[model samples]
Target: MANILLVDPDDNAFLALKGFLACGGHRSTSVSNARDAMVFLRENILVDLIFIELKLPDSTGLDFLRTLREDYFFQHVPVVFYASKTTHAEIHEAYGLGVQSFHRKPYLQESIEDEVAKLEGKAWYWSFFEPDDAFCRRTGRSLDERGAALDELEPVIQSAAQAYKNVNIELAEAEKEKILSEISGFRRKVREVAVPGLEEYLSYLASFAKESDWNEFKEFAALMGYYAFLCSYRADIYKLERKAKQASAVLDRLAQNALLRSLPPHEVHALIPHLRDYEIDEGATLFKQGDVGDAMYLIDEGRLGIYVAMEDDSEPKKIGEIGDGDIVGEMALIKNAPRSATIIALKDTRMMRMEKDAFTRATIQSPQMKLAVQALAAQRSMDSIKKRAGEIDISAWSKTASEGVRKMGERIPNGFLRKDEKESEDIKREAESMDHWNKMIDSQTFPVVSDAKLKRDIAALKGCPVVGSAVAAFTLATEGMVTSLHPLMDLAEHDPGLAFQMLQNANALRQAKTKDLESFIDDARLCVNFLGEKRLSVVTKGFPRCCESFMYLNEGANWASHIKFLLATANIARFTCAEMELLNIERAAFLGALLHDIGKLLFLRVQPAGCIPVYLHAQEHNISIRESEILHMGISSRQMAIQFVENKSIPTSCKNVIRWVEEPEKATEDFDLVSVVAIARYMCRLCKVGFSGETTQQDLLPLEHSQLWNSIKDRVLQRFNVGNFEILVRRRLRKF
Candidate 1:
């Protein structure tokens, strides 16, 4: 039976898992938290597996796992995380900490059993965790003794190391041949010299060479061969271990460098494994002018000179020098061109090489890195252009220009190109505003519903066969009423839910646009016609399915009331857009109005009883529905609606209007469209056209109070009469 440690604070969860594991023929040890688990582990009890609840009294499951992994004994032990509520980010962190498995607590018992069964057949080995220390440790002989005995091999080892380093650096034909010869001589010397720790064995073989005792000599020869093999193997292992440690040190330095400081830790971690270290001799040419570039190098030690060839076959001139922590050869790699200038080491140097493919992969995962690279490349290109411009014969070019042109140039003031204080202040203000908005977006956190749950709700709604027929009948009746081509029939035969939504949207538009409330007709054809064929098709295809889902999930009375509010808002938006004429997006405005509260529909579907508490909370607090929803769900209804519509094939304009309707000031591009929809929604809420699940009235801000509204008010007021529009809306609200 395998020994398992279970860490959980909840007594019920602990007992349930303990009992289940016992039934499965496993021995189990239980603890209430990470602290107790640590104490239990220190008792030297063997554990084959660990089951940890993400939440504990003392420390988090991830923290416990991280600390456990640091202990050599538990590094190979399998860890399974169990939690009732776990986010994707948390799950990612658990895996990053080397967790073997993750499962939701108190569920998926069978899957957990399967995972355990598979582990039983697997062989556990300590060698898999780390390399054998004996293979890397030196022989028992004193360092001085070994050094004297291997005096002939010391030069060979240094030459071999130098050859390996040169494999990464660019070299001339003569230098390449010299390094290759050194490597060949080193290999030959290693085979000829006596191996360390095998000197006595070799001496015994030499003495027995002339002896008549064949059996004794054979034994001596075998011992000599075995010791030689061990000495060679240990030497290779030690070299590899040293190299790995060096690379790791280089990675640590790179991670903290200014160029990579802005990258996320995970992205920087991904880049560490791909970096390779190289040591260059003093005055070595790293690369030459016009040579094809395949990798970029980071200077770890010493300095390098950048040189450019002069015109007419003159000698290459040193333009600049880069010291430690600077990167070079990146421009050629990024541009996919030959080296712009030759690079040569000024002193004995250590560098890290990152290949083109690895650099491309890294930048793809880190957009900030890509931007920084581009900005640097642009600055270098501009510097090169400026240097070339300075060399040009300006007097020759000026002689070709007209006298009047030269006179005009001479008359211009030197300080005329400088920016005025007002212009400079405007630029600074714009920059500050963008920076503030970026921080605001980054800091805001929204509650994310899983895709599986949302899909399941949609599927359940679609499976209700009655919704489709009801929607089709309502569509035909509404069309007939708007066209005046058929008699008005009783609404009982058709789907009341569909008919109610249609009537509300129609009347809402009429009240917002017309001077009289009586002029409003309860019809769907008008909305469809106003949307035009393309937009109408998009709305008709998706909106009906959504409405059916809402009807299937919610009570009829509540669904009807919610749809009425949306319809009234849509109608008001259409009227405002038509009257203002500033934005020619009447169809988009109407569509935005209808879908503004779509997020509420999703909330209702996910939790049918969730709205009751939200409304009650808003009523008690005397707040708006948006504010109440944010308090209850960690996001406003507008954010939820934006997430839902992102997956649909709707027009971007319509989506933007819906997204920014609640906060018109945030609409950077479609300000007019967003403002019109916002005004209409606010007016409808003020009029209380239908129940919006908000029991108490919310305070309304005047149009003049908003910066966005004030900016466009003069233009709108010049053509439209706001006083007359309010009178018309008040009269229309009396009927509702």
Candidate 2:
């Protein structure tokens, strides 16, 4: 039960407010005017809460609030002013005068109840005292006078009890009830209630109790009734005070817990009021895989195992482990990513859980700190991997061979420090390296791609480390073709061209003495410089062109037949070319295989912007090129010309290559060229082959024998290194 003081000018408003307070279990006092309120306070001043209306009969409510604030003792007590549609300026002014809150007039009954509850709920240390009223109330009654009134009221109970006993003997129960009801009705109507002068206060008192303990007063039983009401009222008010204190304590505890969870150890110690010790048992599972998780656990003691389910097995595999002084489940908590693994206690563990809300607040306050912690975790993971590595054998012959290479790299001049740095850098570097190697070995590392498409896209491109080596070798082996291009020779004649002439002179002098077949075999450098440029340019661009040709969707079958012809041309070019006799057949075959898609240059270039058109003719110069009679006639003319040249050493004419290009299907799968061609064509559609398309390799190569490795043995080997192929095939076949 709260002790409410309602200060309002309207009589009806005062009565309504007083009645409302009574229903809410408060003993309310009303004051209609500021002057009379000051007088009442001088007489009695124990107000738990004050609700002053903005309007008063005599003066402004704001002025009274200012007066209350000026008095040092009244500053602690909360004051809520009543208003009806107050403007922002008025509200700001009221708060400036030290009012705690405000209540709008004509509010719902529940709203009034909420304001009263707020007052009662507050801790009692800030309530008003006697000095507050004495400062302004001109009545000379001191603090002692108010204290005396309370003391005097305590003794009135015994005298009232004796009068009530006398009344019970004289009056029947029915008449007593009737008299009480009539008195309640009269008091309800006639009460002026506001803080009036002492004379006015006494006048109402006199009317209420005519003759104290008289024969009629005893019969009415008013004395016992009044004493009981005073006793119960004091008891109820005390209970409310106790409940308010308990609520305040709970709020403080919750605030402390929240602070501790959000802050770092040093800062947490400075902020939290107390630390609650917590623990967990061994084999305890904090969270399981696939669970929606929020809180993260901080390990204080004991070990934990982090396990993830294997891709091929139903049971979980132990991927990692952690121990004291570590934090777990944080990744999922921070990113809301799904839980990657399950954490189970390996030993009895003592840990603290920082809830999601606490984590969010902490992150908002210190983003840099979170990143530093992640960096530390990565370092720890690497360290653990190195530790585990020491216990594994990994000693197969192939493994031994790779390790030997690593060892040799270690022994290179100044190599000791490089190896040492790799070994000594924290575990994080090791974990990163492990993840990288695993992906690289599986081909899953580069990006998922079709074998044929990847080969075609990379064919004869010198930028890649592997392809660059092949290009350099080819350039060195084909230096004899430069003499035929008189235009390029004239362009290279002097001054800054001195370097070019010197190189050509050096190669010409070396070729003069290199006459033996074996001597010529070792002399590939001059040959490569002669014609290597044109061949490489064609091969480098083959992948993209092949991809375009294979990507035809509207008339794919016709395009497939066109691809078959290109493969035949590639095979003839590979085996029939004798000028490259010094190099082994295998090297020639690899070059042939890579060049199988060379026709795509002419094919896709003829397409508009090299785009795959709905009708291939949109990009093609002549839509009938695939079926023209000019193709067979041109090939016949070229063969006749080649037959008339007596020196077989003379290179095949451009017309011969073009004639072959015209009738693609007429060329057979003779030699390994056909297989190499099919593979290049396959890579064209499988964009992941890095050829830039949007479908699977299978869509591009639908032939029953689309897997064309056997048909083009020489050309295929030149593009893909044997060592890399072995590694990839072994990895893929592990399941089998």
Candidate 3:
């Protein structure tokens, strides 16, 4: 609240004296003696308070005080003088020289206070107070009016400048904040809009893959990769989608050529993530039984064989065969069923493989494909039957025939003679009353065979005793029967029992017959030859819708499809049973009619879809399981039985009825096979056997003609007996 100055040549003394003056109602300025006080007065011309020393120190304090009134700079300065030891006369002299107060030589405390009080009474003026005479007044005309106008305008200008400066600072800060916010918002949009858009595009790219669209796939992949790189600034959707699509594209292109088309789109996508390609050498086994089957194989190039064991022997059997336009080892994808067959490459091959889950997904989606795959499966089963049938021994057959001939044993029946003339007369009288019962076997329809009985018969032939000449005769007769059925009979080793069984099964399956059995057999032979052709037309024209279902095990599949197929197969087997051990074979045949091609598992290549040209037994064996698994997945164990066993290589539990019928001794144990065959045969008869009334037995015999059932008649009957065949037909008709 107060401004005070302390100046002194003797600084300590000035400070001391200033402290005493500060106690009054005024601030104080101190200066030593007179010279320093004069200089202080020159610079600071006005003071609210002041002190000076009196005596002869560099001009007396009184003269120094007097100098303040003379100079313009110090003319308005305030001052007081004091002497530590002063006479009354000296004080009187200082007061008379314009000092405000006077003190005696021994200044009493009360006197100093009275003097300081006297100075404070005049403290309002910072300029030196000069009694009333020093006050100035302007004399120009109208000066008061001009000064008043200047004062008013100065306040307006200062207010405007201050407001402008404040507004400028606020605007600058607001602009800076706005720019920062806009940048942040732009970045957010880029992530939300731009990044996700790229991902969606990438997803579409993965969907449209095809060999003809190779350029499109590559461009899309490049675009996706670029998107991923651009989105690398963050873990955005575009980057993830790009990577996923790239992997899927690889899977799609590399899959067994036609299989990807059959797979569900989503499953194809899933497999794209894990698909790997491999090149294989000729005659290489890709996998064996008991190996982990986490993935399915697709043959990209070259051929391979699927191999399985024969039921009665330890050697692996070639159940079926494959070439291009086939898929292999797909069962591992849906369930954990073990590999029942081994896939082997017969030539250097390329294969595309997918992980198991991806394969399962593919099957679960496409219904149309599921039905189409049955033909290939049935074809494979037929092939296996042919192959295994070749292994049957003819020696036992000769012995059995010879024994039947010998068993008649010289017990000839001749008309008995009467003991007397009276007996002769009685015989003459009896003859007039006698009536004959005529018994004739009428095969008005195609003759059906018992598969079960034939198997047993062949087994019986394996060890029975026979002369070499009889064996030769039996073998020749069987060959002749096959030759009469079809021309293609020459391409494959003919077994009468095998040929008969195929015809019976087909007849039972279709519930129809050829007007001429021989003509039908010839057609079957021609069809087989056509099937053996290795060309694209076989798949596109011959297989098309029929083979589509074979691709259920790709990565992106129709979801949850495999379960339905498995359930359907199981339902037929279970519901058709009249009793636990007795299934209506005709109804089962109808149920399995669609699945006759299940043996195609044997033909799958270790590569993608292709057939192996090599004759390695192991490769052929695996083809059986691969195809079986594809057609009827629920019978994995049965497929394994067929693959590993040497004889008629079907599982005892599933195919036992055939075993019992083939071998009468096993009848009690294998009643189910008997029952099923019986019912199937009955169903075939109901459909009406296929020969026309105009077709003679010779015309019906196997010929060069191409009728469906003509070629395999002999083989069919050998396996299935006439009795079981009739029973199967009757049983089915009863159901209807």
Report, for every candidate in turn, its global Cα lDDT versus the true structure: 0.54, 0.40, 0.36
Model 1 residue-pair collision total: 2
lDDT of 3 by residue, 1-736 (tens): 1334433344334333332332332244455456665555434433444555566456766676667566433344445555555677777766666666654222232454565556454543322112212212332323233233323333332342243224343343444344334324433433332233443443444343322243444444433332323223222222333454454445434433443433223333434445577777988888876577777776766888888865697777667666554567765433466787878878888877767766555443333223223323334332332232222223322232233322223121121111111123224422331211011112212111122422343333322121111122223223312323232332111211222223333333233343432222212233334333332122212110111112223211211122222223223333334333343343433223222222222222110121111111112233332333323222332233233223331223333432332232334653454444333322222222221100111111111121212322332334444444334433433322
Residue 164's lDDT in candidate 2: 45
Q: Model 2 TM-score? A: 0.21
> Judged by lDDT, which candidate is best?
1
Model 2 alpha-carbon miss at residue 659, Å: 81
Q: What tens digits encode model 1's per-residue C-alpha lDDT throughout 1-736? A: 4666778865445444543453354556578888888777655234557789998888899889988887543455678897767899999999998887888644333655776786764423222212233322434444333334345455445444333433333332334445445434544444333332333333443344334343454444433332333334334434444444544454555633445533333345456667888778889999999999889998888889999997876689999999886788998877888999999989998988899999988776554366556656767433332232232233322221222222222211122221121223334533553454345435643322334554455445421112232333333323311433121122211222333344444444456667554443433444434433343223334432322222322221244455567667777788888778755678667766765565665564444334555555554555666777666556665666676555333346656876787677777767777888888876665554554555533222233333445555653557576657755665555544
User: For residues 89-125, could you state the per-residue lDDT of candidate 2 as single tens digits?
Assistant: 8789998877878766543345567777776545232
User: What is the RMSD of candidate 3?
Assistant: 53.2
Instruction: Report backbone clashes per prediction.
Output: 2, 29, 122
Query: Which scores better on lDDT, 1 or 3?
Result: 1
Among the numbered candidates, top TM-score falls to 1
**Candidate 3, poorest ten consecutive residues by summed lDDT:** 691-700
CA lDDT of 627 in candidate 1?
A: 78
Assess the local accuracy of residue 435 in candidate 3 as a C-alpha lDDT between 0 and 100.
16
